[model samples]
Target: MIRARHAGVAAGAAVLLLLTACGSHGDNTQSPAPASSTDLTHLQKLVEDAESAASSAESDMARE
Candidate 1:
């Protein structure tokens, strides 16, 4: 009976340790940088140019 009680206490302690190990203790409250209108416009232009270049490359590869 005492052995069983000891085993049960050990099992409970193991479970508590596992739960504490799995918990996130770091600060994750940082906010993201807000994007401005000009930044969005620039990013959009860059994406458009990249897409145009990719399409041209694909067409050239098909012709080869």
Candidate 2:
């Protein structure tokens, strides 16, 4: 029937759109940036502060 043909064509177009949505276009501009020295220093300071806070909490918990 003509209705069935139209339904099939709609379904095919939907599937093709879905496939292209998920397919990679082989673009080289998606690479991640390298972390700078300042970034590393900031992250290291954050970890140190977290560790210091954890140690302080443990000390407080010990007195409870």
Candidate 3:
């Protein structure tokens, strides 16, 4: 029937509208600057220390 066809069209339009509304509202804001050289070096040192600790732990576990 014509009414049923119109109802289907209206339902489809509602779904489309809901989907568009739910789409991401991404901001155009700029990200912060990259880390400075000093900060990067500190981070590198921390990572190295963590890796060394992990290796020591594994070695101890193997000995046990």
The lDDT values for all models are: 0.54, 0.54, 0.53
lDDT by residue (tens digit), candidate 2, 33-55: 44556755655565565555556
Worst 10 residues of 1 by lDDT: 16-25
Worst 10-residue lDDT window for candidate 2 reads: 16-25
Tens-digit lDDT string for candidate 3 (1-64): 4344444555555554444435444586354444556755655565565555556666666787
TM-score of each: 0.51, 0.50, 0.52
Candidate 2: where are CA atoms >4 Å away? Answer: 1-31
Which residue pairs of candidate 2 clash?
none
RMSD of each: 24.1, 22.4, 23.6
**Local distance difference test, candidate 1:** 0.54
TM-score (C-alpha, index-matched) for candidate 3: 0.52
